[model samples]
Target chain A: MAQTSTLDRGGATPSAPARRPTAPRRSRGLPAWAVPYALLLPGLLVIGGLLLYPLYQMVEMSFYKVGLRQIRPNPRPAEFLGAGNYTEVFRSELFWSSLRNTVVFAAVTVALTLLAGTLVGLLLHRLGRAMSTFVVVGIMAAWATPPTATAVIWKWLFDADAGVVNWALGLLPGPLSELIFGTSDWSGRPWLNSPATIYLVLVVAVVWASFPFIAVSVLAGLKSIPSELYEAARVDGSGPVTTFWKITFPLLRPVFSVLLVLSVIWDFKVFTQLYVLAGGTTNREAFNLSLWAYTEAFSAPPKMGFGAAIAVVLTLILLVITGVYVRQIVRTEDVR
Target chain B: MEHVSRVLTRGIAGHSVWRYLLNSAVVALGTVLAGSVVALLAATAVARFRFRFRTTFLILLLIVQMIPAEALLIPLFLMVRRLGLYDQLLGLVVVNVGFTLPFAIWMLRTFVAAVPKELEEAAAIDGAGRLVTFWRVLFPLVAPGLVATSIFSFITAWNEFVFALTLINDQGGYTMPVALGFFTSQRSTDWGGIMAASTLMTIPVIVFFLLVQRRMVSGLVAGAVKG
Candidate 1:
């Protein structure tokens, strides 16, 4: 019932042949069975070679001691170090803290993004058409802004000196500002200096950039539900809260689940924004798994195998998180 | 405003900035063109045919999509180097294509399914060969979805920072995002110039997003609903 199908049919009508003759499917140079395989060959090669093979390589490298020398064109033999890299990663305090950062950030971001996004989606559903379009356009701009630009803009906003955040805080009543920060003077207060404050800024930036897609998606889901359900609930004397819990939430559960999983996957691996906010590996305290892996592998004195171990650990965690959802999707989809 | 404009002018007029912008554009365009073809073909196969391993392929696409690109970074970096594509734009393009293909194929499958199979059947009945029917009937119908996927691919490639940062070490090969990162990390940072450059980088993505957002949303919803 989506607009895309209607659009596709309408677009195809011009070129679609009118006469319906009765002829069987013909096998020309290629057999009918071979056609799909032919089409899929290029994609299979790319995915197999680039994605799957690298995944195997990452796991394989984790079991060996790969270094810059081992990975060079004229490579040295990598020594097998069964579980050595993993033991190094597991014992390291940095890995534990980075894992905590990754998990906590993802948990907080996924929850807040869903809450804000669903609220905006409901608001959009209730608004007038013109106003809905206006708000959607505004939200779309936020969603479409590149992650790097988003991080930079937020960084500038929270800059210690001459930032709008401090300026606005200073404008508050002296007593209020004093109560909040223990001083009315808000200038030269570094927001990105500490891991806590850095993550606060990051949470704000990430949630701002991400919620729009969820909002738009939830809005589309909302539109698909029959209004008659709401009407029937109204007739049954259901309160707005009851109606939402009983009807809206249940109807949109599938959409919500998909969005939640996708958000978790994205937020857990947040690198670019953290890279910008933490200003590279300088503030090791703010490192997430993605950034930690990158720094470990690529920075001076590269520990390629150690980084691969971290990445493998991260991937395993994500797989555990999404395994059930993937199973459910495969079960529901009639891919026979 | 005048001071801001001066800083913006300085930022926008840098030769290195132009090179970065061009690099970004080339990589993004290459991803779009190459990704669309690969995805479109794969999507058609998954949607239209009941081949062996079809379900497994679908599952693989989902699994690949879920894996963080960062996880593959080290090995892919090595792979690119082994293939003599390191520090090259072609290498970046190939990486982007690989990363973007899973989502594109997954999303485009829904678009392909949205086109009624009867059209192809009708074309076949009219003595049109399989290639003819696919080219004449299926491709046009899938074009809108292709646009949506291309836009997604373009934006993803444009904004990609990590792979580009790690893969291409040469200053001349740096993309816009990498250039912007370098700009921010400088000791004497030009805030106004950085802000201006960031805004410049964001404009194209926003414009394209706004143009097709409605269709894209519906397309996304359709996919989610079907799944």
Candidate 2:
């Protein structure tokens, strides 16, 4: 969001110098144009060698047969398989299950996270300054907790025998608990056992860890709207729901779109929390694409090429989804 | 309360958490320093200079940011092994820097752009050399942004789980997140130990986040929304 409007207001005095083609680059024995290149070289080298090059290598590896032996210290060359791994992945039921798990988990988690986050954001906006700060700090504690830590905390809380969740549930009246959970005895009921339940825990943990960011972002967007619009709506006897839908939602569309896309991308890439909750990829039923890829590539008797294919597929799906956002960013940059 | 302290102590002593803490600190600090310098230079270039491929570079950063880091794990693992950085803390530092650079550069560009060109020109006219002017005028002006970006890098590197989990095979090399991961995966799960270790790992990030929450919320939203 490098809006030059802000910059123009801040530096209105000497803005002309910024646009000059021959701006002062008297930074020693370097040519003017070479200065920028020199400044960019180290960053380019790191991103090129690590990010871009590895992306290329991943695509390349997807078409090969790579394993632990081929990746050893004194490595043997990987045999080229020419899309064999992709075909095999397509043929496997595990791949389809993992894909389903990934998509379903992302869909549920994104919806819940946004809904909770937007409500919290609205509350924060309505509160007094000190109250908002107090609430925000509490939320930040949740938001800033590492994913590993979040999973661990949630896992312990939902432990079969000693978990606070089951204990609290058991304290509820029998018929009410049964009505809600289909049983009064949540005692010793394992929340992380099946694919469905593991995803349930994963959703709670992820939504807890993620919603703060969305809340903060939404709050910021809400703060940017002019209060006069709300006052006028109130004068017209608009209900809170009507006002929000008509004014707030339309005004914050850009922020909402960005947050929606980011949440999808993040939920799609959920790895650490799932890995921990599903107990290190042992539970095949709970495996999302990330866990599936890691298990295939890094576990014993590793099929690195097969894993690469899964990862490539995941990347392509993400790229296609986020391509519009990237184009929008580029257009915004052009505007600036 | 007393039992909690004892459990926390046992968790720390039993798992060699001090070692992991030291590892996380080293990796996070390294990432902050290296990521800041590299990102600052690039941000300055993008903000100040109208260079060729400038728009392309900006677009590339966006695209790179969109790709999940987990997807690159397979090839990066091989590349790290080939580069002889496998299983090393420095390797994690390098990876974290690579991951954090794009956002850091994007955030810092606004800061650099906000600093008026006139101040630098005045410094130059007053016989301040390029390096001198940058250090004196530009760097101080961008220090708040630097702090924000550094904190971001610190949190990212400190909390990084996937890369640390796959890359480091040795127990001694395990960072805090990886170390906490072991408590969950073990057959006889120690809930107290896990909770204590999780608290230990989470405290620093929460503290840092509270210290800068006001600036960070606006900065993050502005950076994301405006871009």
Candidate 3:
């Protein structure tokens, strides 16, 4: 009764009802159904206008043969050709190489990030509080860095002439350097000179940039597990690896699932770092799906329609692969 | 780090790094403010009130998170140009806010829900108005979550490259990340300049992360775990 009276207190007290939170007023205000929608209007407008509408436009453009001339205020009109762009893309060697590179890059980076993250997460769980906080903060500094900056740092650190990485390699004996890298000198060995080596630096930079988030997330997941489970495993004399697989792995399934899907999406579409490392669209052979799409759309003599087609295909591929995870996330949200 | 500061201070391509930093600040701060306001209102509505299609709204947010910014670049370019915001910092701000809104709302919803419902009632019982109650009681409690979400939005805008690269064409309009691209080219190399500028770009992000990282852990987990 008291709650109802206060909630229903009329608009008579103008000052006190400053923001009469369109709260539950079964008596005679706006319908309850309208409130959430009203509040959500701004967000809905932005998403609908910016995200959904553009996506629709992207899909529409994919069916046409539009380019720089077509996109101009006054120019040649675009011609709709159901799948001509897709056919051209499939036939192009550039597309195949980008697809192959993207797949390989995503596969390797996801695996390394998960493995390293989980192990670090476990280490964080086992460590004393101060030490764990110290290590987690240290790694997060890397994750917090902008992607372009990370690429530049790694590129400079691996510079052929005056880089610290090569300088460190020089400190090793000639025979050791030869045995390890199949080379006697690190000088003038361009990390960015070829597709294979650019990916090496790229993989290192991305993994270093990405793993900290996974590790922190895994740490958060680890903290949620009851120590009793670990204690029980210890009493059962289970080995470290055994305990990990039998106990920890089962406990962190959800976190791992979420991380796996997110990492795949992130790595598959990785653009900035790769763009910086490859030194722009200059190196066509090293493009990933995202970069290839960008270069196609915005590069010289922009093939806007063709670029839209690539983006659509990439989205489709991502949808097919990650559709389950997306559904899972939606399902989790449905619980409320 | 020293080299990075030197390059940034000396300027790049005859353009002052400070100018680019100011542009980035405008976009990032604008995103944080605009994204947070809309997200907070929506989050409060979702968390505190029962409404039709609530589940659908939440689900839509998750789907939006999955869509890559690159996929929407083509039409967005047209949209921005048509809106007469082309080559403007405000355009970048709006797009960043749109991209970051779903995330900010989702993360903040959990924090909003964490605030005790009883407190709001207590404040109202004291003859406080709805807005007053929220400001005096709710805002202080939810500030951590707000800070966390705002930081994420800020970083998203600050480091965004693809949209910044595509939307603005003028050399003077460059954001820091896009500006870094100018130092490298096909025929020439400027390792010192690139390294110096890159390090300067990274410092602010790290500083901000350190400030709210503790909340971010819980904030991240909350978004993932909560329905």
Candidate 4:
């Protein structure tokens, strides 16, 4: 939000640089931009060293044949295989299936989380201060918990034989049990084995993990709307739903769009839940691209180059998602 | 409540819960303490100064936020191993601090900047030193920001699975995430036990957020709106 206002303010300042003493002075020895650039150097260096270089190495490794053989003391001659790794990835059924699963997982998770988050946000907003504090705290707790621990907890809850979910389901009256389990035997089905089941479980876990941020973001947007707008709507004899449709929803669109794009990008890269849920080995078809790439890199003799290729592909997808998010945020800001 | 309690207690033994709690606390506390110090100093410098590269530094911090932690796993692991930090809690703390510093600085900078500069200037005109002005005049105003960012840093560090899995090998030294992984085996995963452990693990984070949520909300709105 400040990005738009800050740019406008930044433009106006250059016209009257002489008026404000606090304004940055251009020294004779150094160029005007040098001060700001110099302040930025340490941060730039750290990011370049820590983030950019590794990214570069990943791209390079994707094209070269480097693995256990390359780890040897003398090292074998590494050859540029061009897009051989990418070609091999495209040809592999595991890669295609995982990519498909990843898209489905991300899309479904974003949809579910957005639905849950928006409802909760509106609930808390309507409830005003009554249940707001308690609900907010509960949501934030889910948001803050470590993913590994959360994954473990959900895994147990969904356990076939001894899990609370199945135990609770069994408590339901009559032939519903027979319908769920088939016959009176009534044991729960293995959830992680089937692609459909695993996909559903992953979606639920990811939604639970991510929804709080959306709720809070929406809540923030809700707070920004002047109360006078609602008061004016009420004076016109508008019902609650109509008032929300006409006034609240339109104002929240910018924030909602931003949250949706962020959730999509975040959900696509999810690894911990799927990786843990599958117990490190399941239908490779059920895996997302992140886990698939990880297994490729570190399982057995290790296909580092191939893994790097998958990682590169995943990175490109993330970049595309990010580009869309930035463009939408910029465009919406311009409209305002 | 009774049914929930029964479900929680059914399969979990006492010793494992205690062990898991201990491990989680150690990792979480170490990460928060180390991360806060780095974030505080860095945020203070960037917020208060008008140095040449300040804008560049801020932009760089934003870009760093975009790089996923997964991408840095291998390089960080290698760096830690080289430093003889592998398998140690200290190593985990170091890495968590490094990972959280950019966010901490970015978030904290907004709160620090929001403190009226006039207050600090008044203190300075009265012949107060920079350190005194910061400690007496500025710190109190920014305390909420510190709490919010510290909670964020703690959550990120505590919840992290990838780096913990990569760096630590000894079960005793393992953080909660890696320990959770050990619940699964070739034969069958101990679903009940895993769930109970996970539920237990989530409790502290829940409590921590509950303690800080009000402050966190204000802090987030202030930071984002200001930025």
Best by DockQ: 1
For model 4, the superposed segments whose C-alpha errors exceed 4 Å read: A1-46, A72-79, A128-130, A168-186, A327-336, B1-27, B49-59, B82-84, B129-132, B186-192, B221-227
Model 2 Cα shift for residue A244 (angstroms): 0.8
Interface RMSD of every predicted model, in angstroms: 5.6, 5.6, 3.7, 7.5
lDDT of 1 at A306: 90
RMSD per model, one decimal: 4.9, 4.7, 3.5, 6.9
lDDT of 1: 0.85
Query: Taking the tens digit of each residue's C-alpha lDDT, what string does model 2 give over B1-227?
Result: 45347544554425567778889999999999988999999999998888788888887887888777888998888878878899999888988899989888887787788899988766554545557778999999989878887887798899999999888887888899998888667633667666777888888998888887776666677677663
Q: Which residue window of length 10 is worst by lDDT in model 3 chain A?
A: A22-31
- The TM-score of chain B in candidate 4 is 0.87
For model 1, how does the per-residue alpha-carbon lDDT over B1-227 read when each residue is reduced to its tens digit? 54346544554325456678889999999999988999999999999888899988988888888788889999999889888999999999999999999888988998899899878766554556667888999999999999998898899999999999989988888899988888888832567778877877888898888888877767765655342
Query: Candidate order by lDDT, highest to lowest?
Result: 1, 2, 3, 4
**Model 3 agreement with the true structure over B59-123: per-residue lDDT tens digits:** 77877777878888888988898888999999999899989998888899989999999798767
Q: Write model 2 residue lDDT over A208-327, tens digit each, in one string.
A: 999998988888889889999999999999999999999999988777877888889889989999998888878998888888998999989999999999999999999987887876
Query: What clash count goes with each model?
Result: 0, 2, 1, 12
Q: What is the DockQ score, from 0 to 1, of model 3?
A: 0.53
Candidate 4 local lDDT, A240-286, one digit each (tens): 88987899889887777777877877888887877787777456867
Model 3 segments more than 4 A misplaced: A1-29, A175-184, A330-334, B1-5, B124-129, B186-189, B225-227
Point out where model 2 deviates above 4 Å: A1-28, A176-184, A332-336, B1-15
Q: DockQ for each candidate?
A: 0.55, 0.53, 0.53, 0.23
